[model samples]
Target: MPETIWWKTGTVYQVYPRSFQDTNGDGVGDLPGITARLEHLAWLGVDAVWISPFYRSPMADFGYDVADYRAVDPLFGTLEDFDALIAEAHRRKLKVILDFVPNHSSIAHPWFVESRASRENPKRDWYLWRDPAPDGGPPNNWLSNFGGPAWTRDEASGQYYYHAFLAEQPDLNWRNPEVRAAMHDVLRFWLERGVDGFRVDVIWHLIKDEGFRDNPQNPDFAPHQPGINRFSQVYSCDRPEVIEVISGMRAVLREFGERVLIGEIYLPVERLVTYYGPDLEAADLPFNFQLLETPWQADAVAALVAEYEAALPEGGWPNWVLGNHDRPRIAARVGDAQARVAAMLLLTLRGTPTLYYGDEIGLGHVPIPPDRVQDPWERNEPGHGRDPVRTPMQWDDSRHAGFSAVEPWLPQTEDAERRNVDAMRDDSRSILTLYRRLLSLRRDHPALSVGGWRSVPLPPSLATEVFAYERFEGDETLRILLNFGSAERSIPLEDDAAKQETWSVLLSTRPGRAGEATGNVLHLSPDEGVVLRAHPSS
Candidate 1:
């Protein structure tokens, strides 16, 4: 068999370490916990596992605020534990992608501590620092994504440091060559240890507008939007210079051949495509967040998909995401019935699919009581908490949903007792079963995995509720139909010759319904999705 480049034609499952599993009875998940769970990933048949940050931190912004890049926090485990995880995952034929936070470092990081020690320190320029405006306010009108101002005054150093997130995460000055070189060394540290790739966090925010210009007020700002949206981020983020920084990081990956680089970027499709770099020299996959932010409507999502496909730069691959540690679960956003269709769409889409940890078992938003809230963003911003979505994974019906022996650091999903891996494993109608079937189909059929794609047009009456597409390689064409509405919809094959071609149901999101339709016009149930292959012409 020829060597296969898995990143281009495989799915990734995102594992938030602190919530994955706990083996030490410390109410927190650890590296050893992840190693023990590798078998589950292999069973699911994912190509790679993307582990979110597990580095040393002050727990201010969780692991996103990295204090030490090379060491795993004792709360997680020792370096030996991480090496064991890598070995186990590889032994099971799974690639490991580590979360890399190069945009910022925790205030407690030795580099940040040294940089803030004095104005004349050699490391002073490693972080962004500026004097306050004449009125003794922030140097600019920058805002944090979490909430409030992005700049915090440092009394000891008499300067205000800028952060794209919490003040605990000080933005690194990538313009400083020393800062760039230091981050490169961090990447090397892990690559030398046999890590496969990196999911770079907030990569678009690496370089800001050099002049420190005040962000202009947004004409469309609304009270319902987050405070960070009060001003457009033109000056504060997604700067043109950031691509050069991305290219430099890509060069480092080249040093370790076959290692992929996935960037966490939230810019517009046009701007997002630029990060691919000329000749595809930037990120191997700049994460596509369109599905996460777009309105959950059939026509709206269909247009977004086609638009994204049209915008891809030559030789650049596409990726998709519905939820992650930062966003709400899809089941909560689209309801349970529609989540099934989403599963079909994600698995059959024309690019890499990233599955959030608990999404497979239909985990929804779990409320976090005031005292149990661990996310600092939630503590600082009352209504905008992410703690609800970062709950523990539900493994069984045991206490804490079998994620830990004691209460978890955060709450598990409200229905985890009934909806968990153990409960769904044996049920053919469960969402987990649908996911397993979809993954298996993708593995068995090339038309569904690496085939060419074309959008199948629907009548105007069914346009808003239905999305139809087809993928074909040679004579094999797989037609996919999804109903986003609550009412059933019937779709007729458009072409006369193609319509006459007999078809068989390969799978359906609705269980016990496969192999039911054998006619030209396919009947679809409410919130249903199905995949069919045209029989060879006799």
Candidate 2:
């Protein structure tokens, strides 16, 4: 039998470069700083690390606005530094995935700069541009993700350029043959440098409606939702033509054997599966962000997972994420105790799992003061900034949480002193210990790694407050149970005959929970989660 790909069976850890570590004393994390901390990840047992964009940029939208896809940004150190980081990570048996932003580039990029110079410029077709509507406003009703109109008028060219995100990041015209070719070359550049894969950013927006048609309004949009939610994004993104563009990127990855491509697509489960392409030619994983965005209720999360599993096409694989740099931390979303349960769920689920940095230590969103805010989105839309979750890593109780010698670019969480890698390492009851335990169990047991997932029935009374699922591989089966409520509950085990058999506790969220039992009912404390191996023999 052929061995499964690392990305398929391994967990990926995401590191936000600016906040991971700082070895330069400049209050900013660089590639070398990441290199210095590779041991921590190896100790934590993550299978891979996906670093966000670190390419040359003008700091418009952090590194998301790419000025030079081919060069390493000075803030992140030289190309040599990135090379060293990759070498060190591989030496520790970890695969490295880089963030690829094909939807747009920094406005200062030469292609965009030349395109704006004149309508006749040779590079004009490299980016999306359109003449203003009769009203002399934007070309369409498309809105920028940061807020306001998506099109910024280019006065010199008597036209407007479209930007799905910040005006500083102009959308690339993937419809153009030259634009597609250039982006493919960018993939080759990284592959040649030995990147295991890419996490393509805003991949759904690669090809928009050719007619520049207006996007329809989302009827379900609530007033409290983000401004962009007002539009259904029908014409602005997820066009049918995107499949071809994704296939092209996939072809580049195919040239390098054993590599992977992950898409950052946020769409309904049905539409999201299309990115897999016929026969799985698109992304290896169209990142499943449900665990991050779904409601925290047991029933809702279970339904989302079941729905997503049913929607996946043949040859398509699923992935899970609890949190990322763009959203609030998992601990912040579900409270500290439940975060441990989330970790257990992420690792045991039947797919590749992506772990955001700092999540293992139960890090939550930190409050950012108005005076020190650095996120552009927060500046554009006051309460919507991502700065809180992008704060420096809490490494120790030392000054600045040991992330930097001087002040960090962003503030650390208020509990930084107590909730850090150093503090959690020796404490068996800590969230970090729970994460390491879960990861180790996943690696040691096939039932927890590549097993098939099936829901285990519980009593109707416990269904809403408790989640129970069984992972089966070969003859071994592992069951995981999580309690979301604040009181103790006895979860009924449906199999009366199996009650005659013994079950051994593999691990539990609560510290010091280890034993074997033979019973029809399992007692679970509030916010408790446990994994048990069933011995079916009489």
Candidate 3:
């Protein structure tokens, strides 16, 4: 591994601001609160902090439905507060990346307000709008992610507006040259504000089918409609024109040296790679969500890792995310023990790893009572709720889990005392300790950051329960072994294996067992994992 900037050497901590920490008695996390906790993040050894939307929004989809891209939402803090946060984060040697939602804007946005004011308004073409059908219905048969129709008839203009998400978040008409320029200005505004980079929201959705054709019905329709299933998105998103738009964004970031542009693309490996563009001029790293979407099988996980590595464009960086504000926490996905195993995989993988804020403490989802749910998606679709993962972060066992001095806007987990950061920080065997060790190892070892990865094939019997891979740089090589099943497993090693003699255990799920290696036969308990460095046998 060679010396590189903070992005290549350290982990990224993603903070869902509204739920991270509340400084005022407002019961919502704000920039000042984040500024105060920079030391805690610094102690965890992360090089960057990816703050989810704090931009002015209608709160229809939290901050995703942006009302103003350049201003911080009053609910979160003021522009001055955001500036303070950026200064504080940089002082602590942490880069700040904001969540840039470019695909859509809140219907209440001034641009949209004027756009809907009249069909002939200069801004009218800034959003996707179509004339109603012969029956006075939506233009086409498209569905929003939140269920129901993706189009809403605007009685004001006798036309229908397209919305890929919530009705209030009308999809931006990226086809319009003016719309593109305006969105780029939004990027320039933040870059000038000393922000490090952006985690682009729904980068692939920046373009849509020009014809507004009805999406082909899914071949396999389950209880969920084809429109809700991924198949429908083939025509609706990841369009070829999106690559050019991404390139324009890349050009914006290149103007600012080393500024990152990460895309949130949920397509297959083949299509997802295109987000990097034909000549690698698109997004720097299209967020690899394989871990979040893949099953917990060892063989399956191993295959996906290998495929993703091979698919990355030349000079394009790779990034992985285990949990996010929008999805279920990894702990709930794989159970407690496996969550630790997944952590080892995330940190040791040959790329930048992003850790969701509460994940380090092994935080589980809080069961949100119906009345307490705030997500419009859940409110619109009663049974399919996203409230569990969006619960307030638990900091201490105090009232409201220390996330707020008053009752939290979102429900706090019931077991906050047992799972809060304070309790875990002091426990040697705690998940928090494991996270610290893993991140520190990456920070200290150059090999872990820029090494070449090679899949170490395990025997069929061992492969079913254990996923193993090796990353090497020059004479140094590190082997990562993870047991994904509920059983102990071992694999035979070559007699003169790389790093056979001096190879030491770098990290392990079991407490106090890191930095020690025994022999050729590596043993891992159920849902256990280890990172080992090979020492050459002299």
Q: Which pairs of residues collide in model 1?
A: none
lDDT of 1 by residue, 402-423 (tens): 8899878887777777999999
The CA lDDT of each predicted structure is 0.89, 0.89, 0.85
Tens digits of per-residue lDDT, candidate 2, 69-175, equal: 99999999999998999899999999999999999999989888898888888999898889889999888899999988899988877889999999999999998
Model 3 TM-score is 0.96
Instruction: Give the Cα-based TM-score of candidate 1 against the true structure.
Output: 0.98
Ranking by TM-score: 2, 1, 3
lDDT-better candidate, 1 vs 3: 1
Backbone collision count in every prediction? 0, 0, 4
Q: Each model's RMSD to truth, in Å?
A: 1.6, 1.3, 1.9
Which 10-residue window in model 1 sums to the lowest lDDT? 1-10
The segments of candidate 1 whose C-alpha lies over 4 angstroms from its true place after superposition are 1-4, 494-500
Stretches off by above 4 angstroms in model 2 are 1-3, 494-500
* Residue 339 C-alpha lDDT in model 1: 91
Backbone steric clashes in candidate 3, count: 4
